[model samples]
Target: MSTVPPLNGSWLLRGRDGSLSAYAPRDEAVWCRAERHPGLPWAPPRRIGGDQRLHAQLALGQGADGYAHLVAWRPTVPGESGLVHSTHFRPHLAALDWVPIGHPDRKGDRTGLPAVAVDAEGRAHVFARNKGGGVGMLAQKERGGWGPWRDIGGPGAHEELAAVTGGSGRVELYATTSDGILRWRQEEPGATLVPDEALEASVRPGTLTALPTSKEHTTLFFADLEGMLHAWRPGTDPVPLLLAAGPGRVSALRCTIDDHDCTLLAQRSASGRAVFAACPTEQESAGLWWSESGPQLPVGTRVALAEDAEGRVVAATLSPDGELRVARQKDEPGLALGAWQSV
Candidate 1:
């Protein structure tokens, strides 16, 4: 049988245009600016709203009321470290038209990476990593200013946080922790953040996808450190074994557990081989869902280029052909690859 052809696309994008944007603290206001990209000559960056430095981990969230509410937390500098001095970034609204937000708070000297969630009424919840290396207080945004910052629960330690709209006035916060992923209630009675539960995955920075389990239900997916991924819920413990180990360090982890689509994409450092493996939980023997971008070519190290909805894979490498190469499963019962592309 002939090998099936997989999808084709460009190499992973890199350059100045890809620089990361961060929210920094000005004297009494927060400055939303671009900082970390391969090469964009930004003019010392710019400022926007809020008073404290927001964490870079807060990805751009949903926009509403003609404004994009940025969620961020600032860690305390070593000297002024304390529960009182640690957190500095306060949540605020940035107008869709590009108007700056709050005045910088000179008195507040501390901040950390804060997980942010905004509700239907534009209420924002800010959670931070603190001086003692624990999760910090929860703060909210009211009208044009920030309400007082309240301690959610140092008990529930979270490195990354995800917030989504749920029940009556309640917003939900999901977090990744050493013990597992956990959650806390917000916007209602018992809205205090506590240890919701353990996550199935054993790490942070995992890609999260929201799934609707029932008419009024939803779940999340996250990958662990060992290349394994898990399905999680706010109060329930993570369900493990969602995705088995892939080709390399989980450069790209995807879970369609809601659809049983447990495909993991990775790259091998030693062989410069790209792998696309299927991770079936019920079947222990499904083994690796892999493809070699250039096992035959002189590849120094493999870097995952991209993967799509159809389980197709692409990788980039420093080979004679080009930096970006192609790897796809052919119809011959195994995966195959062609030459590399310049882009």
Candidate 2:
């Protein structure tokens, strides 16, 4: 049996101008490729920044300005120390060099994979599991600097954390803990995030993810211990969605299809094929459906989903052999997907 790998972070990003940029970890460094337009061929992958083996998948977070922020956590070695670093990508400009964000610990390197979300004002907030199994965060200062790492509190938090900017411009965070789900919400845009004990559920740790459904609301999704998928939001109980065919992480993105607002999802199935599902935004109770969309992924693959400038949903997967497969939403009807293209 092929063992599943740790959950990889978001590797596909859509810039403000409708161009798509894909990133992957390779040869102790991160590589990037971009499309000038929707139907144009993707540029060959190019390595970005200096070489340092990443400890987890590269995390991409974009602000309202369409700038993509890249974050990664790397291990320390004899002559070097492990740390979390970040850089930003903007169209027509070279990517900024990776700047060390420091580890969660001042005297030690006990940090897990880093997750980041850029706020409306373009400040990048990065989160990682600390030495005490709690989440620590470092945010960009509006005046132009990085803030100190602070423990945001998640006593038994899992390493797979998801951070996203809500439609209202505030940032929200969700993490699966030993007890239930822990969430942090910003009272307002660029404000401090307050912690709350989210509605309890038996969430399979790495499968926890969130999709912003409205300016003030976001829906959380995860598989239960039995591989059953459920969707939940504040003030409501979890609405069971469907049974997942595997134990892989779920990637969800809010998009529009046939003039209707919808939420699209992608996950690697038990047989190693990438599968997709969709439903009207926040209407999982109405009806939700899933189908296989691409070729079998190599062992340990995670599908990343994003919406391009043309309002079509795009799914991407990076295989172990360094191959990138992409699929886009077809225009015909409900959640139809075009053939997978290897770039």
Give the CA lDDT, 0 to 100, for residue 122 in model 1.
56
Candidate models: Cα lDDT each: 0.41, 0.77
For model 2, residues 1-343, the per-residue Cα lDDT tens digits are 3333243456788777778887766556677888866557888777665665665456668888878788865666553344555564553345776677787766465456678898889998888788888888888999988888888887888888989888888888998877778889988766767896476778788787777899878898888988899998877888999898677568888888888888888888888898888888988888776788788787777688988777788888877656788888887987777899998
State the local distance difference test value for candidate 2.
0.77
Which portions of model 2 show Cα errors greater than 4 Å? 1-9, 76-81, 91-93
Residue 240 lDDT in model 1?
A: 59
Candidate 1 residue spans exceeding 4 A from truth: 1-58, 63-67, 72-111, 137-142, 156-158, 167-169, 187-215, 234-237, 241-343
lDDT of 2 at 161: 90
Highest-TM-score candidate: 2
- For model 1 the TM-score comes to 0.46
The best candidate by lDDT is 2
lDDT score at residue 32, model 1, on the 0-100 scale = 42
Quality of model 1 by C-alpha lDDT = 0.41
